[model samples]
Target: MTQALPSLKDHCRTTVAELIRICQDRAVRSALRPLLAGIPDMQIRAMRYLPRNAPVNQDLLYLIAGLVAEYPCSLPEPNNVMSFGASLYKLSQHPDIKATGIERRLESLLQLELDSLMQPLHSLVVQFSSTQSSKTSIVIDYATLLYHLRCWDDSRKWVQLTWARDFWCPKEDGKEQNSDETLDIVKS
Candidate 1:
């Protein structure tokens, strides 16, 4: 069985010869086919090798890596998903990237948006005083929450949350200033 195995040089030569023959097939224009067929055989065979483990010259490896992975692509950035960044970007951009677990993020953004819509929420940075039996009350900023829900493309809920319209950003120096926080929305 080992004796039947062809030498690397012989295999390389045979591959080049076959490729040259295929490229020169009569169906194609004779003048152009021969010129295009002139590519180095070594390069063609390299495709077969590099693709396995990114196995050099391996067609399967290269082609497989070139494809898109769907579901996981919808996940947000900086979480550092995917073996390659470019591939991850391409995956996210795929048309099939539907609303998966993004609803939870939507919920989070909605809460934030509601907080933002309300009056520049008291940050309690400059503490004044605490009352007797100082109860720690937490206010859910529903208005800002609605804004995030709106931004999340839950436009159907727009009518439901429409009656609730308010947006306020805190300011220093008594001047209008853009809020420092923003939720970057990505369409899934």
Candidate 2:
């Protein structure tokens, strides 16, 4: 009998818990600080938490791990419903946020190709962390971030569309409003 592989959500949940543990340990966090600087070659410290030769995008995984290490947060949402997009939406609505700044940043991020995504994304995640730090602890869905990164290269750019919807279509009465319109606008 063969063992079944865990789903991405399950894998991410486990990975996130490991990342939180790293964040809590000063020594480990210090060792992994290089990852926050986008050190591509010095991956030995990060290698232990990563899968061994899995048929997955290692670059994206490393990027996510680095981001999580840099901005430590507890995963308050359930793994299945955790959403980077939703967090961005909440950030956009933050009272301290400058709406136009976030709008422009998100627009630029959506236009970037996979190769150019890391730096801008790092900046935005940092911004998200800073903006929320004073009022509430920073929270982000690492699983959703990884999933979106993997899907970023799809021809239709569905991940981008979904992000735009999450940002623009605020929920009302326990449902999303004008999400279809937001998606259509994103498609053009």
Q: Highest TM-score: which candidate?
A: 2
Q: Each model's C-alpha lDDT?
A: 0.25, 0.66
Number of the predicted model whose lDDT against the real structure is largest: 2
List where candidate 1 sits over 4 angstroms from the true fold. 1-4, 26-188
Every model: Cα RMSD to truth? 26.2, 4.7
Name the lDDT value of residue 1 in candidate 2.
100
Tell me the lDDT of model 2 at 146. Answer: 70
Write one digit per residue (lDDT tens) for candidate 1, span 20-122: 3433333321322222222345335434322122112333212211111100012222122111212212222334433232223223333444324211111
Clashing residue pairs for model 2: none
For residue 28, model 1's alpha carbon misses the true position, in angstroms, by 5.3
User: Model 2 reaches what TM-score against the true structure?
Assistant: 0.76
